[model samples]
Target: MNNLEKWFHSNLGVLRRISQIGALVLVVLIPILNKNEIYILLGNFYSLSIGNLEIADPAIVAQTILLTKKVFLPLLLAGLIPIVITLFLGKVFCSWACPYFLISEMGAKLRSIFKTPQPSLKNPKPQYYWFIFAGVMLFAIISGVPIITYFSFPGLISSNIANLVLCGIVGVELFFIFVILLSEMVFDSRFWCKYFCPVGAVLSLFLSKNTLKIKLNSVACGNCEKLSESPCINACVLNLNPKKENLYPYCNHCFACVDSCQNYGNALTITFQNKEK
Candidate 1:
Protein backbone atom coordinates (compact mmCIF):
# COMPACT_ATOMS: atom_id res chain seq x y z
CA MET A 1 0.00 0.00 0.00
CA ASN A 2 1.05 3.60 -0.57
CA ASN A 3 1.70 6.11 2.25
CA LEU A 4 -1.82 7.58 2.08
CA GLU A 5 -3.49 4.16 2.14
CA LYS A 6 -1.31 3.03 5.00
CA TRP A 7 -2.16 6.16 6.96
CA PHE A 8 -5.91 5.66 6.44
CA HIS A 9 -5.82 2.02 7.55
CA SER A 10 -3.82 2.89 10.64
CA ASN A 11 -6.14 5.75 11.66
CA LEU A 12 -9.51 4.34 10.58
CA GLY A 13 -10.02 2.22 13.70
CA VAL A 14 -9.65 5.27 15.93
CA LEU A 15 -11.93 7.33 13.72
CA ARG A 16 -14.63 4.63 13.73
CA ARG A 17 -14.46 4.37 17.50
CA ILE A 18 -14.86 8.13 17.92
CA SER A 19 -17.72 8.31 15.42
CA GLN A 20 -19.62 5.47 17.15
CA ILE A 21 -19.42 7.23 20.53
CA GLY A 22 -20.40 10.58 19.04
CA ALA A 23 -23.42 9.13 17.24
CA LEU A 24 -24.70 7.43 20.39
CA VAL A 25 -24.40 10.72 22.25
CA LEU A 26 -26.29 12.62 19.54
CA VAL A 27 -29.15 10.07 19.45
CA VAL A 28 -29.59 10.08 23.22
CA LEU A 29 -29.06 13.79 23.82
CA ILE A 30 -31.35 15.25 21.16
CA PRO A 31 -34.47 13.87 22.84
CA ILE A 32 -33.34 14.94 26.30
CA LEU A 33 -32.66 18.50 25.24
CA ASN A 34 -35.91 19.08 23.40
CA LYS A 35 -38.17 17.03 25.72
CA ASN A 36 -41.75 17.60 24.51
CA GLU A 37 -41.14 20.89 22.66
CA ILE A 38 -39.60 19.09 19.67
CA TYR A 39 -42.78 17.02 19.20
CA ILE A 40 -44.95 20.12 19.24
CA LEU A 41 -42.80 21.65 16.56
CA LEU A 42 -42.76 18.47 14.44
CA GLY A 43 -46.55 17.96 14.70
CA ASN A 44 -47.22 21.52 13.56
CA PHE A 45 -44.69 21.19 10.77
CA TYR A 46 -46.17 17.87 9.59
CA SER A 47 -49.85 18.99 9.72
CA LEU A 48 -49.87 22.33 7.89
CA SER A 49 -47.14 21.26 5.49
CA ILE A 50 -48.29 20.89 1.88
CA GLY A 51 -48.35 17.50 0.17
CA ASN A 52 -46.06 15.40 2.45
CA LEU A 53 -43.52 18.23 2.48
CA GLU A 54 -42.92 18.03 6.21
CA ILE A 55 -39.83 19.83 7.43
CA ALA A 56 -38.83 17.83 10.53
CA ASP A 57 -36.45 20.58 11.54
CA PRO A 58 -37.46 23.87 9.94
CA ALA A 59 -34.77 25.62 11.96
CA ILE A 60 -32.04 23.73 10.10
CA VAL A 61 -33.50 24.27 6.59
CA ALA A 62 -34.49 27.83 7.40
CA GLN A 63 -30.98 28.65 8.59
CA THR A 64 -29.37 27.04 5.54
CA ILE A 65 -31.82 28.68 3.12
CA LEU A 66 -31.31 32.06 4.79
CA LEU A 67 -27.53 31.65 4.70
CA THR A 68 -27.67 30.75 1.03
CA LYS A 69 -29.82 33.80 0.22
CA LYS A 70 -28.31 36.40 2.56
CA VAL A 71 -24.71 35.35 3.26
CA PHE A 72 -23.16 34.32 -0.02
CA LEU A 73 -19.66 33.67 1.31
CA PRO A 74 -20.43 30.81 3.77
CA LEU A 75 -23.01 29.16 1.50
CA LEU A 76 -20.60 29.29 -1.44
CA LEU A 77 -17.86 27.65 0.63
CA ALA A 78 -20.26 25.03 2.01
CA GLY A 79 -21.59 24.17 -1.45
CA LEU A 80 -18.08 24.08 -2.98
CA ILE A 81 -16.74 21.60 -0.41
CA PRO A 82 -19.21 18.77 -1.26
CA ILE A 83 -18.76 19.36 -5.00
CA VAL A 84 -14.96 19.24 -4.69
CA ILE A 85 -15.14 16.18 -2.44
CA THR A 86 -17.50 14.40 -4.85
CA LEU A 87 -15.17 15.13 -7.76
CA PHE A 88 -12.02 14.04 -5.95
CA LEU A 89 -12.88 11.72 -3.05
CA GLY A 90 -16.20 10.37 -4.34
CA LYS A 91 -18.44 9.31 -1.43
CA VAL A 92 -15.98 9.57 1.44
CA PHE A 93 -18.61 11.49 3.36
CA CYS A 94 -20.87 8.43 3.23
CA SER A 95 -18.08 6.09 4.33
CA TRP A 96 -16.67 8.39 6.98
CA ALA A 97 -19.05 11.07 8.34
CA CYS A 98 -22.45 9.39 7.89
CA PRO A 99 -23.90 8.04 11.16
CA TYR A 100 -25.65 5.20 9.33
CA PHE A 101 -22.24 3.82 8.30
CA LEU A 102 -21.17 3.81 11.95
CA ILE A 103 -24.30 1.85 12.82
CA SER A 104 -23.53 -0.61 10.03
CA GLU A 105 -19.98 -1.01 11.20
CA MET A 106 -21.30 -1.73 14.67
CA GLY A 107 -23.55 -4.38 13.14
CA ALA A 108 -20.61 -5.94 11.29
CA LYS A 109 -18.65 -6.12 14.53
CA LEU A 110 -21.56 -7.76 16.28
CA ARG A 111 -21.89 -10.29 13.47
CA SER A 112 -18.30 -11.33 14.17
CA ILE A 113 -19.44 -12.97 17.42
CA PHE A 114 -21.47 -15.52 15.47
CA LYS A 115 -18.71 -15.93 12.85
CA THR A 116 -21.33 -14.75 10.36
CA PRO A 117 -20.02 -15.19 6.84
CA GLN A 118 -19.37 -12.13 4.72
CA PRO A 119 -22.35 -11.41 2.42
CA SER A 120 -21.93 -12.54 -1.19
CA LEU A 121 -22.12 -10.23 -4.20
CA LYS A 122 -22.38 -13.12 -6.61
CA ASN A 123 -25.53 -12.52 -8.70
CA PRO A 124 -26.02 -9.26 -6.84
CA LYS A 125 -28.91 -7.08 -7.93
CA PRO A 126 -29.45 -3.34 -7.69
CA GLN A 127 -32.52 -2.75 -5.50
CA TYR A 128 -31.98 0.97 -4.85
CA TYR A 129 -33.03 1.97 -8.36
CA TRP A 130 -36.65 0.98 -7.65
CA PHE A 131 -36.76 3.25 -4.60
CA ILE A 132 -35.23 6.08 -6.59
CA PHE A 133 -37.81 5.60 -9.33
CA ALA A 134 -40.64 5.62 -6.80
CA GLY A 135 -39.27 8.76 -5.18
CA VAL A 136 -39.17 10.55 -8.53
CA MET A 137 -42.74 9.53 -9.42
CA LEU A 138 -44.07 10.59 -6.01
CA PHE A 139 -42.31 13.97 -6.22
CA ALA A 140 -43.53 14.57 -9.79
CA ILE A 141 -47.12 13.72 -8.95
CA ILE A 142 -47.48 15.27 -5.49
CA SER A 143 -45.61 18.49 -6.27
CA GLY A 144 -44.53 19.18 -2.67
CA VAL A 145 -44.09 15.58 -1.50
CA PRO A 146 -40.65 15.05 0.00
CA ILE A 147 -41.06 11.25 -0.20
CA ILE A 148 -37.31 10.66 -0.13
CA THR A 149 -36.99 12.64 3.08
CA TYR A 150 -39.53 10.47 4.94
CA PHE A 151 -37.40 7.32 5.07
CA SER A 152 -34.13 9.04 5.92
CA PHE A 153 -32.92 7.32 9.11
CA PRO A 154 -31.57 10.48 10.69
CA GLY A 155 -34.78 12.38 10.01
CA LEU A 156 -36.94 9.42 11.07
CA ILE A 157 -35.05 8.93 14.30
CA SER A 158 -35.17 12.63 15.15
CA SER A 159 -38.88 12.95 14.40
CA ASN A 160 -39.80 9.75 16.23
CA ILE A 161 -37.81 10.72 19.31
CA ALA A 162 -39.60 14.06 19.42
CA ASN A 163 -42.96 12.38 18.89
CA LEU A 164 -42.27 9.95 21.70
CA VAL A 165 -41.35 12.76 24.05
CA LEU A 166 -44.45 14.76 23.15
CA CYS A 167 -46.85 11.84 23.45
CA GLY A 168 -45.24 10.65 26.71
CA ILE A 169 -45.49 7.14 25.24
CA VAL A 170 -43.18 5.14 23.07
CA GLY A 171 -45.56 3.62 20.50
CA VAL A 172 -45.21 1.56 17.30
CA GLU A 173 -42.39 3.78 16.01
CA LEU A 174 -40.39 2.76 19.07
CA PHE A 175 -40.98 -0.88 18.15
CA PHE A 176 -39.63 -0.29 14.67
CA ILE A 177 -36.66 1.60 16.08
CA PHE A 178 -35.90 -1.28 18.44
CA VAL A 179 -36.12 -3.80 15.58
CA ILE A 180 -33.68 -1.71 13.48
CA LEU A 181 -31.30 -1.36 16.41
CA LEU A 182 -31.52 -5.08 17.23
CA SER A 183 -31.01 -6.06 13.61
CA GLU A 184 -27.96 -3.84 13.33
CA MET A 185 -26.60 -5.39 16.50
CA VAL A 186 -26.91 -8.84 14.89
CA PHE A 187 -26.16 -8.35 11.18
CA ASP A 188 -24.21 -6.09 8.82
CA SER A 189 -25.40 -2.46 8.91
CA ARG A 190 -24.71 -1.88 5.20
CA PHE A 191 -27.76 -4.04 4.36
CA TRP A 192 -30.03 -1.08 5.16
CA CYS A 193 -27.45 1.52 4.04
CA LYS A 194 -27.18 -0.07 0.60
CA TYR A 195 -30.80 -1.12 0.08
CA PHE A 196 -32.57 1.88 1.64
CA CYS A 197 -30.89 5.28 2.21
CA PRO A 198 -32.03 7.82 -0.41
CA VAL A 199 -28.97 9.95 0.35
CA GLY A 200 -26.70 7.13 -0.79
CA ALA A 201 -28.87 6.73 -3.89
CA VAL A 202 -28.42 10.42 -4.69
CA LEU A 203 -24.67 10.38 -4.04
CA SER A 204 -24.13 7.39 -6.37
CA LEU A 205 -25.22 9.54 -9.34
CA PHE A 206 -22.45 12.10 -8.70
CA LEU A 207 -19.62 9.55 -8.65
CA SER A 208 -17.55 9.96 -11.80
CA LYS A 209 -14.20 9.12 -13.41
CA ASN A 210 -12.47 11.70 -11.20
CA THR A 211 -13.71 10.01 -8.01
CA LEU A 212 -11.52 7.71 -5.94
CA LYS A 213 -11.99 4.01 -6.75
CA ILE A 214 -10.85 0.61 -5.52
CA LYS A 215 -8.75 -1.06 -8.21
CA LEU A 216 -7.61 -4.71 -8.15
CA ASN A 217 -4.33 -6.05 -9.50
CA SER A 218 -5.24 -8.95 -11.77
CA VAL A 219 -1.67 -10.29 -11.79
CA ALA A 220 -1.80 -10.99 -8.06
CA CYS A 221 -5.38 -12.25 -8.23
CA GLY A 222 -4.92 -14.67 -11.15
CA ASN A 223 -5.12 -17.68 -8.81
CA CYS A 224 -8.13 -16.47 -6.81
CA GLU A 225 -10.20 -19.47 -7.80
CA LYS A 226 -7.37 -21.93 -7.05
CA LEU A 227 -6.81 -20.50 -3.58
CA SER A 228 -8.74 -22.14 -0.75
CA GLU A 229 -9.24 -18.84 1.04
CA SER A 230 -10.10 -15.36 -0.25
CA PRO A 231 -8.72 -12.71 2.07
CA CYS A 232 -10.02 -9.63 0.28
CA ILE A 233 -13.49 -11.05 -0.28
CA ASN A 234 -13.56 -12.31 3.28
CA ALA A 235 -12.83 -8.82 4.53
CA CYS A 236 -15.41 -6.99 2.45
CA VAL A 237 -18.60 -6.16 4.39
CA LEU A 238 -20.55 -5.43 1.21
CA ASN A 239 -19.73 -8.93 -0.07
CA LEU A 240 -17.87 -7.65 -3.16
CA ASN A 241 -15.06 -9.67 -4.72
CA PRO A 242 -12.52 -7.10 -5.97
CA LYS A 243 -11.27 -9.64 -8.54
CA LYS A 244 -14.54 -9.08 -10.37
CA GLU A 245 -14.84 -6.41 -13.09
CA ASN A 246 -17.03 -3.31 -12.80
CA LEU A 247 -17.89 -3.34 -9.09
CA TYR A 248 -21.40 -2.56 -7.91
CA PRO A 249 -22.40 1.12 -7.53
CA TYR A 250 -23.26 0.57 -3.84
CA CYS A 251 -19.58 0.39 -2.85
CA ASN A 252 -18.88 3.12 -0.27
CA HIS A 253 -15.07 2.87 -0.63
CA CYS A 254 -14.72 1.63 2.95
CA PHE A 255 -11.21 0.11 2.31
CA ALA A 256 -11.84 -3.11 4.28
CA CYS A 257 -10.39 -5.14 1.40
CA VAL A 258 -7.19 -3.09 1.43
CA ASP A 259 -6.82 -3.92 5.12
CA SER A 260 -7.49 -7.61 4.44
CA CYS A 261 -4.73 -8.13 1.86
CA GLN A 262 -1.93 -9.69 3.88
CA ASN A 263 0.25 -10.54 0.83
CA TYR A 264 0.45 -6.87 -0.37
CA GLY A 265 0.75 -8.36 -3.87
CA ASN A 266 -3.01 -8.18 -4.37
CA ALA A 267 -2.77 -4.50 -5.14
CA LEU A 268 -6.36 -3.45 -4.51
CA THR A 269 -5.47 0.22 -4.27
CA ILE A 270 -7.72 3.27 -4.11
CA THR A 271 -6.84 5.83 -6.77
CA PHE A 272 -8.32 8.55 -8.98
CA GLN A 273 -7.71 6.55 -12.16
CA ASN A 274 -7.77 2.88 -13.06
CA LYS A 275 -4.35 1.26 -12.74
CA GLU A 276 -2.34 0.60 -15.93
CA LYS A 277 -2.74 -3.02 -17.05
Candidate 2:
Protein backbone atom coordinates (compact mmCIF):
# COMPACT_ATOMS: atom_id res chain seq x y z
CA MET A 1 0.00 0.00 0.00
CA ASN A 2 1.16 3.49 -0.80
CA ASN A 3 1.57 6.16 1.86
CA LEU A 4 -1.74 7.86 0.98
CA GLU A 5 -3.69 4.60 1.18
CA LYS A 6 -2.05 3.72 4.46
CA TRP A 7 -3.05 7.09 5.87
CA PHE A 8 -6.66 6.73 4.68
CA HIS A 9 -7.07 3.27 6.22
CA SER A 10 -5.56 4.54 9.47
CA ASN A 11 -8.17 7.32 9.61
CA LEU A 12 -11.20 5.23 8.55
CA GLY A 13 -11.61 3.84 12.09
CA VAL A 14 -12.47 7.36 13.21
CA LEU A 15 -15.14 7.85 10.53
CA ARG A 16 -16.79 4.52 11.32
CA ARG A 17 -16.87 5.49 14.99
CA ILE A 18 -18.46 8.88 14.30
CA SER A 19 -21.08 7.68 11.81
CA GLN A 20 -22.23 4.89 14.15
CA ILE A 21 -22.67 7.27 17.10
CA GLY A 22 -24.65 9.71 14.97
CA ALA A 23 -26.92 6.96 13.62
CA LEU A 24 -27.70 5.60 17.11
CA VAL A 25 -28.69 9.06 18.32
CA LEU A 26 -30.96 9.46 15.30
CA VAL A 27 -32.67 6.06 15.79
CA VAL A 28 -33.55 6.94 19.41
CA LEU A 29 -34.39 10.62 18.94
CA ILE A 30 -36.27 10.52 15.62
CA PRO A 31 -39.04 8.37 17.05
CA ILE A 32 -39.53 10.80 19.92
CA LEU A 33 -39.93 13.89 17.77
CA ASN A 34 -42.86 12.94 15.52
CA LYS A 35 -43.56 9.24 15.30
CA ASN A 36 -46.54 9.58 13.00
CA GLU A 37 -44.84 12.10 10.79
CA ILE A 38 -41.76 9.92 10.53
CA TYR A 39 -43.94 6.92 9.74
CA ILE A 40 -45.57 8.85 6.95
CA LEU A 41 -42.18 9.85 5.60
CA LEU A 42 -40.93 6.25 5.51
CA GLY A 43 -44.22 5.00 4.11
CA ASN A 44 -44.20 7.53 1.28
CA PHE A 45 -40.63 6.62 0.44
CA TYR A 46 -41.54 2.89 0.20
CA SER A 47 -39.96 2.10 3.54
CA LEU A 48 -42.38 0.65 6.10
CA SER A 49 -42.40 1.77 9.71
CA ILE A 50 -43.12 -1.25 11.84
CA GLY A 51 -44.62 1.33 14.21
CA ASN A 52 -47.59 1.90 11.91
CA LEU A 53 -49.62 -1.17 12.78
CA GLU A 54 -52.82 0.10 11.24
CA ILE A 55 -51.04 0.22 7.91
CA ALA A 56 -49.17 -2.71 6.35
CA ASP A 57 -45.41 -2.78 6.85
CA PRO A 58 -43.01 -4.83 4.73
CA ALA A 59 -41.75 -6.86 7.66
CA ILE A 60 -44.76 -9.14 7.48
CA VAL A 61 -45.30 -10.30 3.91
CA ALA A 62 -48.32 -12.42 4.84
CA GLN A 63 -50.00 -9.46 6.52
CA THR A 64 -49.43 -7.43 3.37
CA ILE A 65 -51.17 -10.14 1.35
CA LEU A 66 -54.25 -10.07 3.59
CA LEU A 67 -54.34 -6.27 3.52
CA THR A 68 -53.48 -6.08 -0.17
CA LYS A 69 -56.26 -3.65 -1.07
CA LYS A 70 -55.28 -1.32 1.76
CA VAL A 71 -51.60 -0.65 1.11
CA PHE A 72 -51.34 -1.92 -2.45
CA LEU A 73 -48.49 0.20 -3.71
CA PRO A 74 -46.28 0.13 -0.62
CA LEU A 75 -46.85 -3.58 -0.16
CA LEU A 76 -46.05 -4.33 -3.77
CA LEU A 77 -42.90 -2.28 -3.65
CA ALA A 78 -41.77 -3.88 -0.42
CA GLY A 79 -42.51 -7.45 -1.42
CA LEU A 80 -41.08 -7.41 -4.91
CA ILE A 81 -38.23 -4.91 -5.12
CA PRO A 82 -36.18 -6.30 -2.25
CA ILE A 83 -36.45 -9.84 -3.56
CA VAL A 84 -35.47 -8.81 -7.05
CA ILE A 85 -32.57 -6.71 -5.78
CA THR A 86 -31.42 -9.58 -3.62
CA LEU A 87 -31.18 -11.83 -6.67
CA PHE A 88 -28.38 -9.66 -8.02
CA LEU A 89 -27.28 -6.86 -5.77
CA GLY A 90 -27.42 -8.84 -2.55
CA LYS A 91 -28.84 -7.03 0.51
CA VAL A 92 -27.86 -3.54 -0.48
CA PHE A 93 -30.62 -2.16 1.71
CA CYS A 94 -29.10 -3.70 4.83
CA SER A 95 -25.79 -2.01 4.07
CA TRP A 96 -27.00 1.33 2.78
CA ALA A 97 -30.58 2.07 3.85
CA CYS A 98 -31.89 -0.02 6.74
CA PRO A 99 -32.13 1.91 10.02
CA TYR A 100 -31.35 -1.32 11.85
CA PHE A 101 -27.97 -1.45 10.11
CA LEU A 102 -27.11 1.88 11.63
CA ILE A 103 -27.75 0.48 15.06
CA SER A 104 -25.77 -2.67 14.27
CA GLU A 105 -22.87 -0.56 13.13
CA MET A 106 -23.05 1.31 16.40
CA GLY A 107 -23.07 -2.00 18.27
CA ALA A 108 -19.93 -3.04 16.47
CA LYS A 109 -18.33 0.18 17.64
CA LEU A 110 -19.40 -0.36 21.25
CA ARG A 111 -17.97 -3.88 21.03
CA SER A 112 -14.64 -2.23 20.28
CA ILE A 113 -14.80 -0.13 23.47
CA PHE A 114 -15.32 -3.37 25.42
CA LYS A 115 -12.16 -4.76 23.78
CA THR A 116 -14.02 -7.47 21.93
CA PRO A 117 -11.98 -8.80 19.06
CA GLN A 118 -13.37 -8.23 15.60
CA PRO A 119 -15.73 -11.04 14.54
CA SER A 120 -14.11 -13.57 12.25
CA LEU A 121 -15.02 -13.53 8.56
CA LYS A 122 -15.17 -17.31 8.50
CA ASN A 123 -18.26 -18.70 6.82
CA PRO A 124 -21.29 -18.28 9.04
CA LYS A 125 -23.14 -21.58 9.19
CA PRO A 126 -26.69 -21.32 7.87
CA GLN A 127 -29.07 -21.93 10.77
CA TYR A 128 -32.55 -21.70 9.22
CA TYR A 129 -33.73 -20.68 12.68
CA TRP A 130 -35.22 -17.45 11.32
CA PHE A 131 -37.13 -19.37 8.68
CA ILE A 132 -38.90 -21.29 11.41
CA PHE A 133 -39.63 -18.10 13.35
CA ALA A 134 -40.95 -16.45 10.19
CA GLY A 135 -43.18 -19.45 9.61
CA VAL A 136 -44.71 -19.12 13.08
CA MET A 137 -45.22 -15.40 12.55
CA LEU A 138 -46.93 -16.13 9.24
CA PHE A 139 -49.23 -18.73 10.77
CA ALA A 140 -50.08 -16.35 13.62
CA ILE A 141 -50.93 -13.55 11.22
CA ILE A 142 -53.02 -15.89 9.11
CA SER A 143 -54.91 -16.88 12.26
CA GLY A 144 -55.93 -13.23 12.68
CA VAL A 145 -53.56 -12.56 15.51
CA PRO A 146 -51.24 -9.72 14.45
CA ILE A 147 -49.04 -10.76 17.36
CA ILE A 148 -45.77 -9.99 15.58
CA THR A 149 -46.88 -6.42 15.05
CA TYR A 150 -47.48 -5.92 18.75
CA PHE A 151 -44.01 -7.05 19.80
CA SER A 152 -41.89 -5.47 17.06
CA PHE A 153 -39.38 -3.33 18.93
CA PRO A 154 -38.87 -0.66 16.27
CA GLY A 155 -42.59 -0.22 15.81
CA LEU A 156 -43.36 -0.62 19.49
CA ILE A 157 -40.80 1.93 20.52
CA SER A 158 -42.12 4.61 18.20
CA SER A 159 -45.82 3.93 18.60
CA ASN A 160 -45.73 3.38 22.34
CA ILE A 161 -43.80 6.57 22.82
CA ALA A 162 -46.31 8.51 20.75
CA ASN A 163 -49.29 7.00 22.50
CA LEU A 164 -47.65 7.40 25.86
CA VAL A 165 -47.07 11.08 25.26
CA LEU A 166 -50.58 11.67 24.00
CA CYS A 167 -52.17 9.68 26.81
CA GLY A 168 -49.81 11.09 29.46
CA ILE A 169 -48.36 7.59 30.11
CA VAL A 170 -44.94 8.60 28.88
CA GLY A 171 -43.23 7.81 32.17
CA VAL A 172 -43.44 4.01 31.91
CA GLU A 173 -42.56 3.70 28.23
CA LEU A 174 -39.86 6.34 28.50
CA PHE A 175 -38.40 4.43 31.39
CA PHE A 176 -38.26 1.29 29.27
CA ILE A 177 -36.64 3.19 26.45
CA PHE A 178 -34.05 4.57 28.86
CA VAL A 179 -33.27 1.07 30.09
CA ILE A 180 -32.85 -0.25 26.55
CA LEU A 181 -30.57 2.64 25.66
CA LEU A 182 -28.53 2.11 28.80
CA SER A 183 -28.08 -1.58 27.99
CA GLU A 184 -26.51 -0.52 24.70
CA MET A 185 -23.87 1.36 26.69
CA VAL A 186 -22.85 -1.80 28.54
CA PHE A 187 -23.33 -4.59 26.01
CA ASP A 188 -23.04 -4.88 22.25
CA SER A 189 -25.59 -2.51 20.71
CA ARG A 190 -25.89 -4.75 17.64
CA PHE A 191 -27.35 -7.48 19.84
CA TRP A 192 -30.84 -6.58 18.69
CA CYS A 193 -29.79 -6.53 15.04
CA LYS A 194 -27.87 -9.83 15.13
CA TYR A 195 -30.27 -12.23 16.76
CA PHE A 196 -33.74 -10.70 17.18
CA CYS A 197 -34.42 -8.70 14.02
CA PRO A 198 -36.72 -10.63 11.68
CA VAL A 199 -36.47 -7.97 9.03
CA GLY A 200 -32.70 -8.43 8.84
CA ALA A 201 -33.17 -12.17 8.63
CA VAL A 202 -35.58 -11.72 5.73
CA LEU A 203 -33.07 -9.53 3.94
CA SER A 204 -30.29 -12.07 4.45
CA LEU A 205 -32.15 -14.77 2.51
CA PHE A 206 -32.24 -12.66 -0.63
CA LEU A 207 -28.68 -11.35 -0.22
CA SER A 208 -26.94 -14.57 -1.22
CA LYS A 209 -26.69 -13.86 -4.92
CA ASN A 210 -24.95 -11.83 -7.61
CA THR A 211 -25.23 -8.48 -5.93
CA LEU A 212 -22.81 -5.63 -5.39
CA LYS A 213 -20.49 -7.05 -2.75
CA ILE A 214 -17.16 -6.57 -1.03
CA LYS A 215 -14.32 -7.93 -3.14
CA LEU A 216 -10.67 -8.64 -2.43
CA ASN A 217 -7.79 -8.72 -4.91
CA SER A 218 -5.29 -11.10 -3.35
CA VAL A 219 -2.63 -10.25 -5.90
CA ALA A 220 -2.85 -6.60 -5.00
CA CYS A 221 -3.16 -7.29 -1.30
CA GLY A 222 0.38 -8.68 -0.91
CA ASN A 223 -0.75 -10.56 2.23
CA CYS A 224 -0.79 -7.44 4.48
CA GLU A 225 2.92 -7.94 5.23
CA LYS A 226 4.20 -6.27 2.08
CA LEU A 227 1.47 -3.67 2.39
CA SER A 228 0.31 -1.90 5.58
CA GLU A 229 -1.13 -4.91 7.42
CA SER A 230 -4.41 -5.06 5.47
CA PRO A 231 -6.04 -1.74 6.34
CA CYS A 232 -9.27 -2.81 4.62
CA ILE A 233 -9.74 -5.62 7.12
CA ASN A 234 -8.91 -3.34 10.01
CA ALA A 235 -11.46 -0.77 8.87
CA CYS A 236 -14.31 -3.23 8.40
CA VAL A 237 -17.05 -2.87 11.02
CA LEU A 238 -18.20 -6.42 10.26
CA ASN A 239 -14.66 -7.55 11.14
CA LEU A 240 -14.29 -9.20 7.74
CA ASN A 241 -10.88 -9.64 6.28
CA PRO A 242 -11.74 -8.50 2.79
CA LYS A 243 -8.33 -9.68 1.59
CA LYS A 244 -9.03 -13.23 2.76
CA GLU A 245 -12.77 -13.43 2.08
CA ASN A 246 -15.27 -11.09 0.41
CA LEU A 247 -18.40 -13.19 0.00
CA TYR A 248 -19.33 -13.55 3.67
CA PRO A 249 -23.13 -13.29 3.67
CA TYR A 250 -23.24 -11.01 6.73
CA CYS A 251 -21.26 -8.29 5.00
CA ASN A 252 -23.31 -5.07 4.82
CA HIS A 253 -21.27 -3.44 2.01
CA CYS A 254 -20.85 -0.27 4.06
CA PHE A 255 -17.93 0.74 1.76
CA ALA A 256 -15.74 1.56 4.74
CA CYS A 257 -13.05 -0.62 3.24
CA VAL A 258 -13.36 0.97 -0.19
CA ASP A 259 -12.87 4.30 1.49
CA SER A 260 -10.04 2.94 3.60
CA CYS A 261 -8.17 1.02 0.86
CA GLN A 262 -6.42 4.16 -0.28
CA ASN A 263 -3.31 2.07 -0.86
CA TYR A 264 -2.79 -1.12 -2.99
CA GLY A 265 -4.28 0.64 -6.05
CA ASN A 266 -7.88 0.59 -4.78
CA ALA A 267 -8.18 -3.21 -4.96
CA LEU A 268 -11.84 -3.27 -3.96
CA THR A 269 -14.54 -1.91 -6.27
CA ILE A 270 -18.33 -2.34 -6.26
CA THR A 271 -19.65 -3.52 -9.60
CA PHE A 272 -21.94 -6.06 -11.24
CA GLN A 273 -20.43 -9.40 -12.21
CA ASN A 274 -20.67 -10.88 -15.76
CA LYS A 275 -22.37 -7.75 -17.08
CA GLU A 276 -21.27 -5.49 -19.90
CA LYS A 277 -22.22 -1.88 -19.41
After superposition on all CA atoms, what RMSD does each candidate show versus the true structure?
A: 7.9, 6.6
- Tens-place lDDT per residue, model 1, 137-220, is 455345654544454555455456555655565446546645776776665445666555555555565678768887777777
Name the Cα RMSD for model 1: 7.9
Error of 1 at 65 (Å): 12
Cα misplacement distance, residue 242 of candidate 1 (Å): 2.7
Q: How much is 48 displaced in model 1, in angstroms?
A: 25
- Residue pairs in clash, model 2: 5-262, 5-263, 51-155, 88-210, 88-211, 89-211
lDDT of 1: 0.56
Tell me the tens digit of each residue's lDDT in model 2 across 1-277.
Answer: 5676556555654654565555444445544555545443233112334454223334566455553426566565657655676667765555554544555566556657777555444523445436555675666666777555543445455445445544546435445535554565566444454445555555666665366666655556555564334667676665555655333455665677777765656677555564433
* CA lDDT, every model vs. true structure: 0.56, 0.54
Candidate 1 vs. true structure, TM-score: 0.64
| lDDT at residue 166 of model 2 (Cα atoms) | 45
